[model samples]
Target chain A: MSTDDVDAWVESARRGDRTAFTKLFRAHRSLITAVVFRMLGPTGDLEDVVQEVFIQIHKSLPDFRGQAKFTTWAHRVAVNVVLMHRRRARSRPVLVEEEAGGHEPDAGLLPDQDLSRQRRVRAFYRLLDKLSDKKRAVFVLHELEGMAPADIATEVDCPVLTVRTRLFYARRELAQMMHDEPALAGLLAELELAAEGQEQAADADEPARTALGQGRDRRSDP
Target chain B: MTERESHDNIELRPSSEFSARAVRHVVAEVVAAPPPELDWARLETRLLERLESERVTLRSTPPGSLGALFGFVAMAASVVLFVLGAGGPAATRAAATDQLVDVATLPVIDDALGAHSHLAASLAPGSALESGGAARRFVLPGVAAFMLAPGSRVVVRRTGEPYVLELAFGQVTAEVVPRHDTDAIVEAFIVESGGTRVAVHGTVFSVARSPERVEVEVTEGVVAVGPAGYRGDTTGHLLAAPSRATFAARDARLIEVYAPTRATMAAAATPRRDPASLLPAANPLGISRLAEPDAEREVHVRAASRQAPSAPGRDVRAEAVPQPLQGNPGTDATSPPAAGGEPSAAGAVAMSVADARAAMVSCLRRATANAPAASLSVSVSSQITVTLDGDDDVATVQFAPPLRPEIQGQCAGLLFGRAVAGAGSSFVIPFSSR
Candidate 1:
């Protein structure tokens, strides 16, 4: 885990030492899998992406430079591999259940309805689905992952201004979804409550609060 | 009571804030270590063999420079054939002719129209008839749809439009848009496995059969699949939506729909055996036994949870899970092996989860294998509930026809799988059925 040990492993891995390469793969398998899963969706082929990432890491390791952190470089490599792999995936857009025409029928509701909180979150994602793929990436990285805008700009190869603009718009869109979709707004509130609960449990994890506090700084950019 | 009211509540709420938590969970899972003992030895051997054979060329010492000149002349002769698109004169024409045939076959489905019934035919727009099963690739491009009885397998070139497949008992993979849109053309693509009939609408999908399960995946648009009604449950459920995937158990239950990410896709080359969440909820329509007449039993019937309550009149009995086969045996529940005996908890869970997983895996594998032209249709008879162990999230769907089962199930699986594929064990628990 030390920097020195990490440096040696990188050098060894670049030389095609299977053992060294295996060590590196072991260290990052889960991280790579998570990234790939987020980029794709949770469902089928988690293992496929994991194996592919290792294979790609092996194939592309020779180009690694010490300029960036090993994790950063690996992420860069992983991003490309995921995007390419995504292309190879059948370009099918999973559809939502088509709404049946006419007034919403009053079907039976579950007797124990604890779904008040859950339904809202579902609507939020349904709205998030409307954002363009690029905007979505920016939003997910900056807001969800809490990656600094600069880091996102670097990863996505765009200007920081563009990242900021995307974030601004993304928030606006999310906010608008709140206004336009009452169900979504309630869900957002529930989400905030859930997040607050988690925060009270682990004060360390609520980066969103800090991110929110920095709203002034973001606004000052314009 | 109304979607509008649902919207009203959502508007008053805060934004969904599990992003960071979800991401962190994903990070922890992704960064975990691989198991100590994998078939590394075999993988290494394979890699070495490939390197030795492909990277290292055999070098021979010619008898002086004169022999070298002769070698160059022989090399030129070989080069001419390759450069001319063939290794030899006959090979060149054959290759060209095959290309021509493939090109002529441009759209695979058009030819399938009016083709003889019960007879498997090539649908590839322009591919040549090489020989044997290789020729089966052509069947995908031509047919609009076809029917299959138990024990049938068909291969077709990838296409676009969904083809209807009737599965009495067997497996078939149709081509989707493979590297090109023109690759998919055909209409009726049918594979009937265990009385379930799946029709490909406008998506690229595939289906595989085992004795107990039938797997389906939508590589492109969503595919609609339902039970062909061989026995136990006649109603079929939509497996997956566009880009989503699902598997169908022979008991005729549709398992979770999963969306493959880049990583999982890369990791899995063959059908996966990982345990999956349960299928879509069973349809409550026309239940022979129920506690109430309008119990909305369809919604609960397909519920994935073991605790999912059963219909009123139908006696809900707890049964043990069935013993898992050595690996996944794609069995549809209704094909001959009647449910006369009691299943152990281990057996029931294994069967439920395995069958569901197989349906999804088979769907995906077949899509990659066969891209058929024509629109795929999906109709579900009930609601579906997906619950994950160790995770608070449970995806529940109570909606109408053309259900996007793939997306629903995939999201549920991914959400849970991301957090629990390794350390935390999970299974799709089916409720006790009468």
Candidate 2:
């Protein structure tokens, strides 16, 4: 788990040592799977896509200048591969059932609670698919992965303003999409509660102001 | 996870905070789920094989060189020895062994298989097949042939108990071959993954496995999914084709979700409890059956699970699709279906009555395409009232008049497949073919 060992493996893997590459693959396998799953949704072929990312990493390892942490670079690779995979799947926009590993069964959740949670997630992903890949990447990295806007900007090689803009637009689009799905009653209820709570807080001081505080639409100029 | 006031996305509008928190809340299961060991094992094996294959490719000697000549000679020697051994005593031993012998080298009795149902590609033993983009068919020989969906990886093991294909990941539909004496001997083959060996029951079914869950969907007949060497009828779950069984696992604990379709609607009909009435409360339709994966009691449980408080009445998958209700196996249209509980769910993705009728007409068109070109007038005069009772997500009609029993079944299959919300809904369409 030490960075020095990982760096050594990267050094040897760069020299075409299969053992070193295997070690690298073992270390980063889970990280890559999580990245692909979050970026591409559960329907994405995790194993195949992850295998592809590693292969790409193996091929590109020599050029890896050790500038960024290996995990960050791997994340970038996963995002690129997932976007490419989505491009090829343009004809079939239908989402398949969430793969077995998409989520672990939560023993803590009652059967009904688990089902409700799953349906809500499925609804969210269906809406998430509507956004373009760039918007999806930034939004997923920021929202789902809980990365900071600055870190996301660095990961995607874009500006913080661009990342923020994509996150805002993606959220707006998802809210619009979720509005259409009544099955998203659970999530919608939460959204309403949050919006209502915020409105109440804002209205307490500014009694005349009634409109909800809209997040600033940070649209970057083309 | 920050408080609403300090939420990163929700600086002011709660919508941003809602989106982030909402999605995270729902996906907490996935975010925290660890990769199943069986899945990791399969992936690791494949990765090692692939890396080794590529390594050989990278290090192979240049063509026409002495080293290349030696490599060619070695390959040729192995092929010759294999052919000889396959033809010699190995062939004799293969015939005598009860499925334990290597069948890859032996000739498959294709004549014994159903006509037009043979494998697309006759695979050699230990051949690893990957469906890159299109579905590929692999003959399980004496038992059946399975169509591997695109992006699936399977390895055909032909050693001992050779009638097995290890599905590393992805979906594969196996259509069990018809046999005159099929009833006498069990039509069993194994699709092994995740330390589970699913024995094929009679008919067509698909088993889709991921690291943490395995889904068995029956489209034709029933399939038996249980431990290795388990009798499907006696010990295993006889998952009918019209149903889907999802076994989801968290560490050692397992969660099961069984969603029965309209194909089994009559068997799964509920008392007239209105779903719209239940919609305002906790999602009654959003329910799953939690059970220990290894518990085996009786067949009555499977039948009984089709009804009552935990009715296998509605499918949770309908919400995953955002488009109109499209074609499923029985539901022939490319549509999205909202979860079929409330009218709102159906209204979200339910295809129109007009669209459904059009699809029905198309089915008639295909059936009647080869009918004499001369105009033959056939009018369906009776009002086929597709009724959806309360909890009965299934739609049934009181076949008004001269409708054949087969046609009633077919039409029922169509409507039941469209078990959208709104029980007291009514719609009518007229079509005449001359």
Candidate 3:
């Protein structure tokens, strides 16, 4: 939605128009829900967190200076709420199921391709579980979300160097884990070979080379 | 062979598709999982209910209001009459005293008055009553009754032929029956608090008295509220039901009218509940479902593309084309320069790109010093665009992708303080971690 539309709805909602507020809720519910779900993972309190985000948005609307897009501001609020939930959860005991233990292959089937795929998927999440919340968020945004280190820095409110460092560590750790596991070793080698081929191909493509050079310049250390 | 053919010829291992398959799996399992069904209408109703409750909680009541003091006093006088032998047993007291209005049993009163379940409360012309920290209810048979809020003191007085109540503090809700007496003379019921008086014929209203003002809220009938002697004329305001009038003690000339909301009345009538206990519990298994691919998800897929060696140069266009900058919502085309001064040419700013970077490094180092290292990741390179005024003082520093407020504040403090050579120029300083 345009800024003007948001501003109008906000003004109306503040004046006690429930319909206008509902409109605002409808407009941004998806984005807020997605962020909350991603940050908390599938296990935590997704619905409560989303509701809390809206409640907070209503309370904080008066102070909103329109400094950022409504979605961006809402996204930040969701992130903060999730972080707080994480902190509170740490002080309390939580019952979490093992990531890989839940799914059993069909009873009569042999160890087939689908089972192998499911195993790999489970292993991926296991690796993700090893990182701290901050590193995990950074990795998810960069590697999974395809956000640049710079954009991830802005979203997570950290320095670009920090984002890069987390990404570097996350990738290194995942690679090590994959290599250590016999089932994942062959897949890891195959990915590594593809990566090598891609890098080599980048050297041959003129535009790719220029883009790579620019990427390097922008990525230079302070 | 064509490029596509050669690419197709390259042996595709099971693991070659591992990352793609894993991405799809995670997306399907978590990101794309369906959210629990929510009834928006029900949620909205609950939210509105809570908001109404909060509004009533925040509604301002006149301080030192007569409601509190009068209620207490009325209750106290009842106790005093019962203790003294002015009235016999509680049952007989109702018929004995001509001056006594009525006697009724109180279901709930302050713990102090717990022993006296039967309240033989009656106010004579000269009698005064005080209630402390407990609500008192009095039913005047065939005439009028009132519920006195806690901490009230009230004295009954005869101003001419009218029955006038002098409320010193706190609040009271009185329901007076209209005068239908066929007798020769009829007297008006007047509630006097602060410098204001509310005259009622037959109505249900609440009067609150504070040191600063007297407020009257009419719930069921009409009331004339104004300075004590202003006879229902230009000086007095006629208040209908569901309306309120406030008379300031400082300036008798000012009277404020208010329309009380239905929620406010309902809340006042209903007992207050602890707010925290009402919050709904979180649903642990309800992950949000994705209906369609979002911008962020697309970014995720594109990032995955770069990792696949088999898709070398498949579409480098996605990475090469910079996403359009999401401008600061606060900034506009007509916005003033960042330095809060006249816009200056970029060349006019004296600070070199290097100087700004150094400043940013210093600021960021300080800001992140106490923060956990793991929490300090910035995925994208941050571009801090500093605009300097004519005097070379930093006018404004805008972060391309906004950083946390603390970090932004730190950067602003460091860069704006220094005098640059070309004061008006804008310098884009990029901070990259790697």
List of chain A TM-scores, every candidate:
0.60, 0.72, 0.62
lDDT, candidate 3, at A175:
56
Which lDDT tens digits does candidate 2 get at residues B1-434?
Answer: 65321445454233655555655565564455443222666676677776664454333212222111100000000000000000111112111112222223434333322222224345545555555575444454444455545555555544333345544344444444444342332434445443234433333333443335555443333343443311222123333333455443111111342334332332222222321121112221111211223212212333333322221555432332233333342242223221232111122133345555565555444433443345765444443444443433333333333233223333333443343433334444343443
True contacts kept of each: 0.01, 0.10, 0.04
Model 1 alpha-carbon drift over 4 Å, by segment: A37-41, A83-90, A93-126, A178-184, A187-222, B1-434
lDDT of 3 by residue, B1-434 (tens): 65323422434212325444433344344444333345456555655554553343123123333222211111100000000001112212111112333234233232222222223234556444445566555534334344444555444654333445554344444444344343111334445533344444233344543445455544333344444422222123343333344555422333444323232233222332222111112310111211122223423432342343224455322222221112221243211112222211111122344555665766565555553476675343466666554444444455544444334533453343233443245566776553
> Lowest lDDT 10-mer window, candidate 1 chain B?
B76-85
Highest TM-score scorer: 2
lDDT of 3: 0.45
DockQ of each: 0.03, 0.06, 0.03
Q: Residue B194 in model 1: shift from native, Å? A: 36
Q: Report, for every candidate in turn, its global Cα lDDT versus the true structure.
A: 0.37, 0.46, 0.45
**Model 1, span A1-222: residue lDDT tens:** 777877788889777666776677667765765565545433344444455566557667777778888887777676666554443222222233322111222224453332432344344445556666567677666544446777778877899778777766665566655646676544445667987888787776567767876896898887
- lDDT tens string, model 1, B1-434? 55323322333322433433332232332223122223334434444443332111111111221111100000000000000000111211221212223323334332323322222343442232222222122233233222221222222322333332221112222332221223221223333323345444344344433333444533333344543322111123333222222333422344554333222222222232211110101221111221122123322322322232234453222221333322332243211111122211111122244444444344333333332444644322322233332332122222232223333333222222111222223334222111
